[model samples]
Target: MKSNNTLTFSRRNFIRTSALASGGMLIGFNFFTACKDKVAPPVDISQLNFNNFNAFIKIADNGIVTIFSPNPEIGQGVKTSMPMIIAEELDVAWKDVHVAQGILDTKNYQRQVAGGSQSIRFGWDALRQTGATAKQMLVNAAAAKWGVDASSCSASEGVITNANGDKLGYGDVVKEAAAMEVPENVKLKDPKDYKIIGQDIRNVDIDKIITGKPLFGLDYTAEGMQYASVLRPPAFGQKLVDFDDTAAKAVTGVSEVVRFGDKIAVIASNTWAAMKGKKALKVNWQVDSKLENTADHDKILMDLLDGNSFDTRREDGNVKKAFAEADQVIERTYESPFLPHNCMEPMNFYADVTADKVHLVGPIQTPAGTARRVAEMLERNVDDIHLEMTRMGGGFGRRLYGDFVMEAAEVSNLIKKPVKVVFSREDDMAAGIYRPAIKYRIKASIKDGKVTGYHLKEAAINSNMYGLIPNFFPAGAIANYKVDTANYNSNITTGAWRAPYTNFLAFAEQSFFDELAEALEMDPVQLRLDLLQNVKGTTDERIQYSGERMENTIKLAAKKANWGKKQDGVYQGFSAYYSHNTHVAEVAEVVIKDGFPVVKKVVVAVDCGIVVNPLGAKNQIEGGVIDGIGHAMYSDFGFNEGAPEHTNFNSYQLIRMNQTPIVETYFVENELSPTGLGEPALPPAGGAVANAIKAATGQRLYKQPFIKYIGMEEQELIG
Candidate 1:
């Protein structure tokens, strides 16, 4: 079922022997491992096969370059930002470059999964190192032709320049360069000398996206491709029992309806037909009444938190003893709910399988991981499984799972034809792996208007956050005495979503500090400054934040937001947290509208190393902030009979344009390596907004989905 129109880049195989490949569907140029030696070949645009292109790029006989990315692009602007890393150091003009998704090759591209705000951070070294090698090899080849010293020729702006000012384009010398060996030690550009990095660049895919060029998985169609709609388990752990496919086959355009194990699939000629078929198909839903998670799930979580499964994330002094001696001890418990990714485009993928090969494509974030799973499922060599990633609608860590990929590949294998699996908004909501619900019990001791001890005892699944680090952000400088965790197992499985544990930890920690600030009659900003001023510069690997960056972001956000300046009728609250290798500080200002507090404005300060694309970077931060607000104030994860409570936008809530407040962002000046932006901003938004709610209503919220527990939701189902 491979698209006949796909281009064959056999020339690429002719050159680099060290290329590791991953699944990619369409778009981009190929990036080979270039060391101090030559790479496989330069990209030649004229040779491009636009219609039926293999995922990884191939260039020959010219200086054209190709790039195939394996992750889905769900409105994080990854289609442009991720490729910029390769184009930057490759010394290629933006006009001369083309990008594509890889044709599911895993040997060269490992960790093709995209989450944890890790794309740039991970590509920081590998892609640059490869690009430098390619540039060096090009220079070396030109030097050989001119019969001059290698040092006498330098590569710049896609051309090799000799000391005498003679120039040869990268394309001109690519053939000879391809024949050269990869260099052992290629010099990386110093930040000061960077030509493309650390500079403001517009998102490259902006034009394509605006023009509506079938860029996502839903847009993918093979000549004989069919549509599929999966009827999943009604509830977690429930298996399929029996179904009648007669009605489904009678649906217009429906070709086949099959049941495999516990799931059923409806295959049809079009999306409309497949959906209609699913609605018409009737089945005995062996609704298991035993171990009903929707009813008992949240209660189980509450019990776990109430019990002694506590792990210490941070502790200073002896909280219990300090509380006994304290003139005032403020203790509060905070709870957060499970929420769906609810990305606008929903989850989708297309796959074609045969005994010889399997081709998978869609809006997937973890293509390499998908390839591995597909290879395992089909008993095929990992190298033989190909994957293509699509630009996503909105990925708040939803696409991070390779489950969708596996489902597509499995279905394709059963049908032995190309099929695209589409998840409806309902399917995506019900099928999604949700953000874990968590509880925080914060304890603090204050005496004589001075802080002495702070302890945060948090309980969660603990397995969600880790491994997005290029290197750890040093936070040891902060006066934190201890951090630990306790775990619990549940029937519903969970994984990473944005910043993982940091999201819960920051909301609880920062908000608790605000409470202490009010108790001591001190400014929240001043208290944080007092605590943070003692530390500067990056902490070692032992800690997770740059104490200096923390202080800087706090100061900048405070100064810009006017923390102490009183507004006649408005209330303000502040919060700051460091995660994703990015330190973010935010302030939320709001006022009561009718009965509920509505945010009026937000000010943020960020330090994500260097801002590669200011517009793009700022956009990510803004979106993160809004996402955080929705989760804290309204995004509730409830269960009814062991199933997720909300199934669509109607029951669930999302902050929209009218709800978005004016956002102001500032970046740090120093050139540090890039960190993550997608999730760090999210954690603090909830805290900032929660703090504002306290200011506006004189009531502190100790629970997530703030509206639900803030005397908002009806009590009928809350119990």
Candidate 2:
């Protein structure tokens, strides 16, 4: 039997095991077309001895060190921070290191994933060891050359120096180091000795980005790359019934129109022609049923929540008995609409497929997974598939699913040529796969100003598909606690968003806690603090979150926000949550301007252990907070007849720069290992803002995209 807490296969293990098998030293650095004037000659990478180190590090004869970041860089700074771990242990100067993106190779790199913010958390030890192993090899090489003990030589600044002060750069001894066997137990430098790990090093690609270098997926090109635009089904669950491609082929520069299971593609010499050709193609869709509108889905959710049957996720003491015996009970129903990721780059990918092999390059979060899926889809061996990752404008968990990547591969295979599939803004927005709309009912029983019992029932379209563990917070803290979930089947695609379930669950639970605090006649901060104290020394090993860590973050955020002090024209709300192995507490200050919630400031405290880069971590928190606020305030997706009603930004609202708040972040200083910071700061923003809106307007916003309940005209989900 499998244990609930059993660790699963991870990418870090793959890299570590492979590195150790090669004596803990990776060889070879893979380079793409870096110069425009001269095309580099193709060399058989498989024949190079340097291929052993392909995924991690490469040192050139000029002493320039290159580190390949295994995970995709979806604008969360993993490309920079992951290498910092290895570079720190290697005692290398950041300025001398060149960062390169790694290809998807499970045999070499392992789990090269960018979602769930697990890159750093999982790669920390393995990456440090990779660097330490290499550093030791360089030291051993130098010691052997000097005819001295390896222990007598020290490595620093990418060079090894002896007691006599004679120094050899890594480049000078790399060949010798490569000849030496890798040590199985190379000691890593202590955190105190780190020069690059904790520093706020600037992004390696900043210069190239500012200088207009072609780095994004859209900017990439091949010798004979043709642009292709696909016309997907109008609504979810709809299938392509028929299509006439004569009109599409008549369009200037239109090459051909190809049909797939779910969509019709138009390949053209240019992007505009492909788009226009796609538009010109006459197509029809057949729906299985009268397109289920948003109202129908909402009703389905409500019915599930009210049903007696449920998949019990977690249960402690008798919640029914505790609630029945409570002094007072406070309950609220919260609903959140479907949300689109709207990654700035839009969905685009390039694929070149032939009978022998396939090569794909694009902005994807899960390169290795995509490679495997594409290989399986195309009936090809995994080794025959090559995937290259580009810098993503934004992931927000949208790129984790490789449906778009598969589409590109399909189109390339159909056309028998290199093709780039680009989803126009409208196509991207209207295409399904959104954050699942969910409804949460949270009830709390308060007795003598203490929470006695708590119950949460979550109703969602295909619940828990993203591994959103139901008992996220306040689970082990409350004595009489229960979590139940109901799933409603639907045709629309649903997948992970930032923080997944916690993003919306935190809002409902934390906001309800505010109401519970009111019922108990206690401060909101104090109520959470008391709850944390209640679970401090519990013997429950199943409790995933630490009470002490949560308490520290909560206290720090309250202190930073001056929790109880009165302010002019501003009301404060406090919320804390733990997700992705990181603890975050946020305090929001808000005021009603023209009857709309105008957030003035947000004070965030994070405990992700030892922050790899303070500036990057802070920026991630600020971005997560703003993103959470934007989604909570103005973002919502409504489907009419199974299709997204809002096509683009004109109808679907996003947070504007003017609406952003002044965000200040602080991290708990500790010697513990680091966790991910990509998503933890996002969950509490909705709750904090909603609670603040209540303080400002005396009205509790139970529905998401709170703008609908404000002075703005409310829009219904039905057609």
- Each candidate's lDDT (Cα)? 0.69, 0.81
Could you tell me every candidate's TM-score relative to the true structure? Answer: 0.85, 0.91
Cα lDDT tens digits, model 2, 87-142, are 88778888888888766654444456788888778766666666777788889988
Segments in model 2 whose C-alpha atoms lie over 4 Å from true places:
1-54, 106-109, 464-468, 711-719
Each prediction's total of clashing residue pairs, residues at least 3 apart in sequence or on different chains, is 61, 3
Show where candidate 1 strays beyond 4 Å.
1-64, 67-74, 147-155, 162-165, 179-195, 287-298, 311-317, 461-488, 534-541, 709-719
Question: How would you encode candidate 1's per-residue C-alpha lDDT over 45-164 as one tens digit per residue?
Answer: 333333212223333335566665544555655556666666676677766677665434554455555677876775555555556666777788899999999998887778889999
Candidate 2 displacement at residue 384 in angstroms: 2.3
Using TM-score as the measure, which candidate wins? Answer: 2
